[model samples]
Every structure is written in structure tokens, then in C-alpha cells.
Target: MIKKITIFLLLVALAAAAGYGYVTKQVEQYIAQPLNIEQEQIFTLKSGTGFNRVLSQLTEKGIIVGSDFSKLVRRFHPELTQLKAGTYLLEPNTTLAQTLELLKSGKEHQFAITFVEGSTFKEWRQALETAEYLEHEMSGLSEAEIAQKLGLEHDKLEGLMLAETYHYTFGTSDLDILKRASSKLQAILDEQWQQRQEDLPLKTPYEALILASIIEKETAVEEERERVASVFVNRLNKRMRLQTDPTVIYGMGDKYDGNIRKKDLRTPTPYNTYTIFGLPPTPIAMPGEASIAAALNPEASNYLYFVASGKGGHVFSKSLAEHNRAVRAYLKQLRSNQ
Candidate 1:
């Protein structure tokens, strides 16, 4: 009878050992093997999100091999507790170990927003408002208040922010975005101002900024920017009216109907370059660093006029007669298209 009891005890101990080994092997496998996922996945771990919640998320993705054992395994291993919050770009079919390693690193999830050049402050605000994962706080504040909140020197938000793709973590505020853009703009503006050409009509960096905004609206072609700047500078030097239509549209403000007319040019407003002598009262849009550089260092040219070439560019001319010919050609092209 004693021998029978000993045999039964040995059998129970063996079964327990086998179960332990199997669980250990599965835990090791869960920690090592990559899942059968395809494509990069975007996983968001919100602030204060629990590690168990993270485990469940992995289970949902079929990444956890032994889901029941994982809870026990993690409970025994406390080092997997800490987690960071943001939008993580996860590689597909990544190992459970690799994913956890990334989450713990606190640098995996970063998002970006690209502020386009020639975008107005209103448009910039709208973009910030629409961006996912960004906390919107600027929507309620007035533009002037926003400028103040950002600690900017400008009275208004227009032309103060830089145009660039800004990278930030999730839950970042729109104000933070504005602050980064404004700071970048100021830094670039300072550097460009220091490197400006001699005898340029622009008295201050702000004046050059105003001109840069106008140049940004003029053309998108990289090579044409300096020539476009030259035409404006030449016109400014000769006391000729800057008949640029962008300024006229800016002057029209909300009244603009997406079409410029002969009557709009005749009407006088603070932003009307055709009516106003020099630079506009304020920048009409965000000017990139290149546009700012072009405004400060325009090429030496006799160009006094420019008209649309009807080929996604402008035809420049030195004299009024040549300018008139280009204008007539533009009108003829328009009439033909009609």
C-alpha cells in the first residue's frame, strides 16, 4: 500500500512539472516570436493607459500566443509596467517583445503637421483644428489673443508663423504648434535679415517679410522667384504702381468673390498694391524662407512688368510695349480657351 501511494505521488509531480515547462515555453514564445500581421500599424497608447489594456490590444491583434498565461507572466515580471503615450508607428508582424520594447522607450509615437507656404492664418488655424490627436485650444481665442498667448510681438496672427512640417507627440496643443512655427519663423527671419543684400528698399526685416509674402503669392516656380522679386523691386524703385492682383484680392478680404475685376483695382484699400504706394500694411500670407531670401536679394534685372504666360508661369518684360504684347497674348489664350 505504501509503494502504491509513492507511485501516485511521483505521477502527480511529473504532471505538474510538464505543465510548468509547457507554460514556460509558451511564455518564452510569446516574448520572442513575431505575429502574422501585414503592413505597419498605428497603435495609440493614450496617457495613463494601463499595460493590461495594452496586452488586451495585442491579444485582439492575435499577437499574444498564450493570452491567459500572459497575465500571469506579466504579473510575475513587473518590469513591463511602465508605458508612454502617443501615436506609435508599429511594424507589422512585430514580436510581442519588440512592441513592448518600443512602448517602453517613450520615443516611438510621433505625429507631424505640415504648414503650407502661402496659407493664411485662418487656414493655419483651420488645419490645426482638423488635425487628429492634436488638442484644439486656439479655436475659441481671437487671433490677437492667440498672438499674445504665443508670446509673439505681432498684433495679429498673419505672416508670423513659419511654413514647415512640424513633428510632435499626440495630445500636443495647437498653441504648441503655433509657438513652434512662430519661433522657427523668427529664427529664420533673423538669419535671413542678417544675410540680406545691401541697398535693398526694404528698411526692416518686417518690410522684407511683407514683400516676401507678396512674392510667395506671385509664383510657385523656384527659379522665377528672384525675377518676380526683381520686377517688384524695379517697380518700387521707379515709383511705379505694383499692379499685382494678389494684393488687390487681399484688400478685398471676405468681399472677394474668387474673381478679380477692373473695378477691384480701382477701389482703394490698405492692402491694395495698385492703390498703395509701397508695401502693404501687413503680410497677406505666410512667406517661406526662400521667398524672404528672394525679397531681400532680388536679381539685377530691367523687368518692370509680368503677366501670366498661360503655361503655369509668367512672361516678364522690361518695357510697357513688351508687357502689353504679353498681356494681349494672355487675353488671346483666354479667349481661345473660352
Candidate 2:
């Protein structure tokens, strides 16, 4: 009976050893074997999102072996608990060790989005919506709400967000993105303001931004920016109204269709430069570096009027007589074409 009891104890010990060995082998295999997931698969892990979801997603995509190994590794290294959200490039042949290292390192994917020089807030909203990183609809968020989210002051986020190609992870928040863009803009503007030429008409940096917005809308030609800026400078110096078409468009607000009708110009609003204007209350569009510079250093010219010459550029005039003649010439040309 004693011998039988000894044999049973030995059998139980052997069974226990076998189970331990099997677990060890499985773990080793998991570490050495490469994950056979397809290439070109993108995984987006959002901020504050848990590891369990990542594991489940990996399992679903067949990127990892099983939940057991994933759970074990996660428990072992609880410090790697948080993952920064981004678009990750996935590979099928990634080893378990390599994957774990990647998770621990928190390497975020980098991509770029450019806000053009003259883009409006509405245009910016559309651009953000189309970006891969920004998931939230910009349409729902008010400018003030967006500014608050981005830690900006109330009522003016329109020109605050700079025009530049910014790098961010796919999961970057619109708020954070806007903040970075604004910071870059502020830096650029500060530098430009410090180096600005003396005796210019602009009162402050904000005023410079306002005038820059005007210059940006006046023409698309790079060489013409400084020249157009001079026209506005002359008007401001003489206390004459700017009478810019874009200002009227701003005043019209929703009423402005694609075309600026004759009545729209005649209609009165604070932004209608044809009636009342020193500078518009705010920027009409985000101006780029060149426009800002033009505002700071306007080209020397006596010209106060510019009418489109139908050549995708304008003909400048120093007096009302020259302006009327140019206008007549343009009008005649338009009529002839029609």
C-alpha cells in the first residue's frame, strides 16, 4: 500500500512538470514567431484607450497569436498601459518581441496637413474634416468653442491658426492641431512685427494681420501683393474708404452668392468698404507670409484705384480720371466678349 501511494505521488509530480514545460514552450514560441498579418493594414489607437481593445483588434486582424500571451505581457509591463493614438504601419512579419518594443516606445505616425494662405474658416473646417487624423466634424463646433478647445482667446480663431504644413499623428485632436498651428503663426508674426519697417500705417500687429488679409484677397499674384498693399495704404493715409469688394462680401455674410452683385455693393453694412471702412473689424481670410510682409512694407506708389484689365491682373491708376478710363476699357472689353 505504501509503494502504491509513492507511485501515485510521482505520477502527479511528472504531470505538473509536463504542464509547466508546455507553458514555457508556448511562451517561447510566441516570442520567436513572426505575426503573419497582411501588409498595408493601418491601426489607429486613440488616446486614453485601453490595451484590451488593442489586443482584441490585433486578434481580429490576425496580427497577434492569441489573447493569453497579450494579457500576460500587458500584466508584466503595466507601465506601457497608455498608447498615443496614431496611424500605424502594420506588417505581417512582425515578431512578438518587436511588437512589444513598438508598443513600449510609443512611436506615433507622422503625416502633414497644409492650411493655405488665404483659406477661410469655412474652408479650414472642410480641410480638417477631410484629414485622416481629425475624426470630429468641424462643422458642429463653433469658432469660440474651437478656440476654447485649442486654448485660444474668445471671438478670434479665424486668423490665429497659421498657414503651414504641420506634422501630426493620425489620432491628433483638432484642438491640439489648432493650438500648434496658432503657436507657429504667433511665432512668425512676432518675428515679423519686431523686424517691421518704421512709420508704417498699421497701428499694431493685429492691424497688420487685418491689412494682410486685405492684401491676400486683393490679388493672387505674388508680385502684385506689395503693390495692392500700397493702394490700401494710400487710402488709409488719406482717410478714404478702402471700397474693396471682398469687404462687402464679408458684410453680406450668408447673402453673398458666388457673384458680388451690384446691389450687394450698394447695400450698407459695417464691413462694406464702399460705404464705411477704415479696416474691417476682423480678418477676412488667413494671410500667408508674403501678404503679412506686404502689409508691413507697402510698395511706394501714388495709385489709389485698380480695375481688372481682363488679363487676370489689374491696371493701376494714380487719379480718378485714369481709373474711369481703365474702367471704361474693361467694361467695353467685357461687353465685347459677351
Best by TM-score: 1
Q: Put down candidate 2 lDDT per residue, 202-234, tens digits, no spaces.
A: 888888888888888889999999899999999
TM-score of each: 0.88, 0.73
CA lDDT, every model vs. true structure: 0.86, 0.79
Give me candidate 1's TM-score against the actual structure: 0.88
lDDT of 2: 0.79
Candidate 1: list runs displaced more than 4 Å: 1-13, 29-42, 46-50, 57-66, 75-81
lDDT of 1 by residue, 26-125 (tens): 7777677776568777778888878888888877766555466676557555676677776787886678777787888887567889888999988888
Best candidate per lDDT, number?
Answer: 1
- Residue 61 C-alpha lDDT in model 2: 74
**Residue 223's lDDT in candidate 2:** 91
